[model samples]
Target: MRFPSLVSGEFVKRINRFVCVVRIKDKEHFAYLRNTGRLSELLKEGTCVYLKEKDKGKYSYELLLAEGEKGILVCLDSQIAPKLYAEGLPAGELVYEPKVVGGKLDLLVGKELIEVKSVNLVRDGIALFPDAPTQRGSRHIDLLIKAYPKYTPKMVFVIQREDAYAFSPNREMDPIFANKLKVFKSLGHRVVAYNCKVSLEEIKLKEEVEVLWR
Candidate 1:
């Protein structure tokens, strides 16, 4: 997807899950962070970030992407995951924010329920999810497991960056979520991971890659 007018900025500090401070053209401003994930590794002090002007939102600007290690651009917004997934997936009537047993699933295409996760953390060419702990993520998987007999469950990991060689669950950070993923896969559900070709112009879904558990 193509972003709006994005200006470069320096990330100062994150005030909370939704707000962050950034310096654009040497002027400080408050920016809205769309994702709630702990981005300690991605959004650091003095890190280069991309911000888009927001006239109707709570903040003046919204954070779009950030420059991580090795000049990689990581999309900070998690909402892009489901949108890209629905667009790239096979043709079907996509139900956004489908109500589930415990909570709302990301998308429901026909009889298939899919959960989309945006991945930005990568180490040694291996992409990982939930850079921090995610009990809600674990709950989603558990709920999916309970609803398996009636619906086809699938988990999609959308790596925001292009350089990741492979994708894996971050067991070190959230063991329960990782274990639940393993169980969900073992139950014959699908676990898919795909990378995106991200640039300043657009972010499009690329090819599907294998999901690495180890």
Candidate 2:
């Protein structure tokens, strides 16, 4: 998706899950961070970041993109994955935030119950999800499992950068979530991942990458 005119800044430090300090034009400012995931690998001191000014909010700007190792740009907005996925499909094909048996899911394309995850953590060309422990993610998988034959549950992982060649669950960070993904795949549910072409101009779904089970 196309982004608004973004201002480039240097990342100072993350103050909390939703806010961070950034340096723009020699001035330090607080920026709102949409992604709740721990992004230690990307948001380092002096790392280049992109932000959009907020008209009226506690923070002056909102963090949208960050530079990864080797100058690769990564979209840090966790909420954009489903929208990117939906844009690729035909109109009215994807439903947003549909209420299910246990809770709400990300999307419903026909009979497919889709849960979209935003991935930005990459190491050695492998994209890993849940940089931190995610109990809610595991619970979502369980709900998908319960949906079962009534609706085909699917997991869609969107890596927010083009550097990753493959996607995998972060077993070291969240073993339960990784195990649940294995069970979901074993039950004949579909699990797919795609990498995106990210830039200051736009971030779009590029190509589907291999989902590594191990």
Candidate 3:
């Protein structure tokens, strides 16, 4: 997905889960953080970030990406994953924010329930999810497990970087979620993981990566 009016800024600090203060054009402004992850490894003081201006919104700008260690750009917007999928994937009746067994999933493509996850953490060519502990992620897996018989349940992990050779659940961060993912596979549910080729011009889903779990 291409960001039309994005501007470069320096990240100041995260005020809360949904908001962050950014220094744009030598002026400090609050921007909406589209990703809710802790992002302890990515977001830092003075880090270069991308922002998009909003004429009428809670914040003047919205946070898009941040420069991590080794000069790698990480896309912080989780919402873009599904948007990219919806734009690139095959023609299917997509129902957004569909309610599943006990929780809401990202989309319902045809007869399948799909949950989209944005991955930011990549180490040694391995992409991992839930940089922090995620009870909500675990709960979604549980709900998908319950919905497996009636509908095809799928979990899609979008690695928002180019360095990933494989994708896996972050067992070190959230063992509960990792265990539930194993149960999800054992129950015959599907897991799709793909890496994106992100650049200043556009961010596009490129190719599927192997899903590794133990």
TM per candidate comes to 0.96, 0.98, 0.94
> Is 1 or 2 the stronger prediction by lDDT?
2
Q: Give the TM-score of candidate 1.
A: 0.96
lDDT tens digits by residue: candidate 3, 13-89 = 99999999999889999999988888987888999998877889788898888887778778889888888777765
Rank all candidate structures by their lDDT, best first, as comma-separated numbers.
2, 1, 3
Q: What ranking emerges by TM-score with the best candidate at the front?
A: 2, 1, 3
Which scores higher on TM-score, 1 or 2?
2
Tens-digit per-residue lDDT, 1-214, candidate 2: 8999999999999999999999999999999999999999899899999999999979889999999888899999999999999887766777899999869989988888889999999999999999999999999999999888889999999999999999999999999999999999998889999999998899999999999877
Clashing pairs in 3: none
Residues 1-214, candidate 1: write the lDDT tens digits.
8887789999999999999999998899999998988888888899999988887967899999999888988888898999988886666587999998767889888889888999988888888998989998998898788778788999999999888878999999999999999999998999999989888878988878878877
lDDT of each: 0.89, 0.94, 0.86
- Give stretches of model 1 more than 4 Å off: 90-92
Error of 1 at 163 (Å): 1.0
Q: What is candidate 2's CA lDDT for residue 2?
A: 96
